[model samples]
Target: MGSSCGPTGPEPGAAAERVIYLDNAATSWPKPPEVLAAVQHYLLEVGANPGRAGHFRAAEAGRLVFRARRAVADLLGLHNPMRVVFGANATWGLNQAIAGLLRDGDHAVTTTLEHNSVLRPLHRLQEEGRITLTVVRAAGDGYLDPDEVRRAVQPGRTALVAVTAASNVCGTIQPVAEIAARCRTLGVPLLVDAAQAAGAVDLDLARDGIDLLAFAGHKGLLGPTGTGGLVLADDFDAARLRPLTVGGTGSRSDSVRQPDFLPDVLESGTLNVAGLAGLAAGIDWLHGPGGGPEAVGRHELGLRRRFIDQATARVEGFQVAGNPAGPAVGVVSFTVEGLSPSDLGQGLAREFGVLGRQGLHCAPLAHETLGTFPVGTLRFGFGPFNTAGQVDLAVAALAEICRQERP
Candidate 1:
């Protein structure tokens, strides 16, 4: 557990040395070597526009894109790879799903523990008089009961139900499958944001009954930035989803009209072939022989347990945000009595080179639910690249920092 496949400190003679990196929830660092290599191969060897031409390099580029879609499909247990569509990131994917699914006066239900990506879009739609939004508050521990979701959806009136699979701030794993069943019963389509859950938790598209699933490639997927998308269910009609952007999809170019196909219907313009190449490698690494999500989860959970145990024991006024007994990923949020979250985070980085995130972690509603809003909790997010020694370094840094600051 000391060192694995993830990033470590900077090399000698490097001016700004990196120490312990615990901000993986924001974006995983030190992507697998395979991922970097795949990206490099795409840039150097497979240089061509995919699906835009019929040349050999273009075909290779298209194959790279196709392989990426299949990799993501395999990760989500989706049978049809064509149902997956690429975008800039999960924000793009979420926007497409939310904006495409709902219309004027249509009602949608969501949870309080949502990132701005979900909240902002719904709020914009609501403000525009496009859809009526209902926010189901989570329990004090950041847990949402499926019954609460069931109660929020207005049966036939609710057009869509959106929820994050895991809280970005506190790492609380929601009951998406249960909520999906409820959505099914209510005849409502369910859109799940797996930004925090993908590659950290298990997700089966068919088994979970998720109509639309959006996820980031860089987070738990361990891919490069600017790569993410959504996967539509097999029976889910692409015709219902209006294109967020319409342009040359490299298919059906004769009519100058948008193509009506699974990927082409949503994907327009040149695809991120290089980014997808790395993403595909990341997914393959996660599901392949060298590494898997199960192994990664176990490692990160061990680090989480170590940090929580050591921090609570060493720090006088330490407080954990969510219920530790509940299901979660490798995220932990806490606060100390005397030090502000910003101060602690900055001090950790400055003094010990221990990188962590502070504030609401881009999920204000989550912090509000955890009663840590306005002033948020310090967040430590462990990843596959992290080590047991790094966790110890973080704990020691926290203990020392708290001891020095406390009266």
Candidate 2:
């Protein structure tokens, strides 16, 4: 798909050029024009608290949110939109899933490649003596073996298996289908954190045997920040979970207790109407011509291949992290010898006007698994708006920085 701005030439003077954003995994930039238009439309034409009032405006707001829910459901191949619940972000959704499902003495298994969103919650649960956690170690390349996960599943006690569809740091796509198959055979619920893979790859909940899918709308979904959701299969009962939040859901107004339903049971507050409106538009764009997950993934892989070839050949002391052969989204991380990732990131931003992410990327476990802890690798995440020229520019900037630092 062509970028929002048509075929502009590269900015002049690499050091003084306009900013080139390569941090889509953190949050996408230059959102689709339709997304901005939808947000504006919601704010100007229909601004009302959704699911709260009977007026036309309020009803329109509710419809917009519902349409967003339906769009997300369709994108993920979910049958029921009610099963998809929105939250502030993926971390919030993940916390709700973990805290709601696991109980005292129940066992849960997860891979070492999980982000802090998954690890921190499970850690707290473990510390509280609520559940026993079995962390299946990944290979040195940050790829988890499905057999390892299967081995970790203790049949009767295992309640859930939490795994990321792809690592935000290393971009290693897990074998979620295989893991889900094992979970199915063992009768354990499989929850996938698809923060990095949602809009970059096709995720069929039924086909993949995924019981629960958590995704960040802002990252790969090309939506605004504070938009994220969870998809629950019909077989996964909400009754098994404790409501993370309890308050007005615009349902059961006379009752004091929260409503016992899918969305209202968990939503518990005023919805992000504008954000959802944009998100719905973004999903629509994704489903439209040349903008689905497959097309996006192929485009990104082409960029990644270019980056890998150029950086490895030109930049000395730079090594790509994780298994180069593993399937990945648009995210790529690499380490530079004798330079802190933060420093490199700063230089890239200040000198080259290239915006990229640094540090452990909220996935300390992943960095630990990749042996890139303490000093993390520099990450460049591509978005739908990024171009091949931007990738080349980023690589050239890195090579120049290395030369300057060494010579």
Candidate 3:
């Protein structure tokens, strides 16, 4: 962070293997040592269901869960940890927020730069005639206009406005804060899919006026795959929303009904306590000596810039999707002439040990917004653990792939 952090050697916790990992958008790899240790400690020492029993191990597990909930809340700028609901993944969080909040005949607004997590739920609701949906289009570069979002929200009818903080495909960080401000002015609830933006960019849910923030632990938080949740704004009323699931919360043992509380309302049954232990350690590691989000952002963006410049200059017929001249996360989608995305991605991995994702990357609408529909671009997602030298090697592999394609 103090230096350019240019990779003269392997990144922290990185392996010596030649297989380079670049698909960080789906899930980060080589998690910090602390995360792994936390998980192991939980499994070995505190193997109990949190808030389920009066046993000491269960209490300890409950404490671990609370710490993780608080850390996640603090990460998003919320003071109340109970406002955060831990679930299986960001998709679960999004589904809970969308399905639990909107009622029959209610209308919602979203953008084209959305992952299927947000899209499928809303589409299902629309198909079921439960809610009316309005999808706002983003620019070719995947930038969504806050004014366009405001125009889409029908003052009293629009119950929720769901949008991704960044594009999972091209790494375009949307003006979510601006959209939040607009939603606030219009008295509408805003749910942000922070699967991509959580650790890649700075997010202040309270400061940004975001009512509900859904994020994944595995992707940006560097936690285990089963950990993620939704955070409710401090002043937001929980009574306005309902739980998608209702069963034993371990607190409402005396009553058959779900507990009418912040976390218990949404979080039903057993949670991923082991995964949450990893998430807690991951958050601390992220903001500790390893690097905060700003440092991580700088490192990844610099790597992205390096790859883009080198690939454009050295590889013939290399083309990148989206506008490359703005503040963005590390995900970059590109194509080479005379090659399909899957072929190039496979070639890069098979021939040179470079790993990256090909195809829509679960964001077909994002690909369509960038005009890379049906067929997709090979995507490289740089992470905080990535290095400049790694990008250089990947770009060289890409150049070679293009070279073979040319002949």
Q: Write the per-residue lDDT of candidate 3 for residues 1-407, one digit (tens) a residue.
A: 12366222124542535678899988997687789899999999999999899999999999999999989988899999999999999999999999889999999999898999999999999999999999999999879999999999998899999999988988888988899999999999999999998887899988899999899999888899999988999999998878888887888699888889989988898999989999998888778855787677777888888999999999888888997768789889998877899999999999998999999888888889899998999999987777777888999889888878665
The estimated TM-scores of all candidates read 0.95, 0.95, 0.97
- Residues 63-119 of candidate 1: C-alpha lDDT, one tens digit per residue: 999999998998887999999999989999999999998878899999999999999
Best by TM-score: 3
| Candidate ranking (lDDT, best to worst) | 3, 1, 2
Q: Flag regions of model 2 displaced more than 4 Å.
A: 1-17
What's the distance in Å from true for residue 300, model 1? 1.4
What TM-score, to 2 decimals, does candidate 3 have? 0.97
Residue 196 Cα positional deviation in candidate 1, in Å, after optimal superposition: 0.6
Which candidate should be chosen as best, given lDDT against the real structure? 3
**Model 2 vs. true fold: TM:** 0.95
Ten-residue stretch with the least lDDT total in model 2: 3-12
lDDT of each: 0.87, 0.86, 0.88
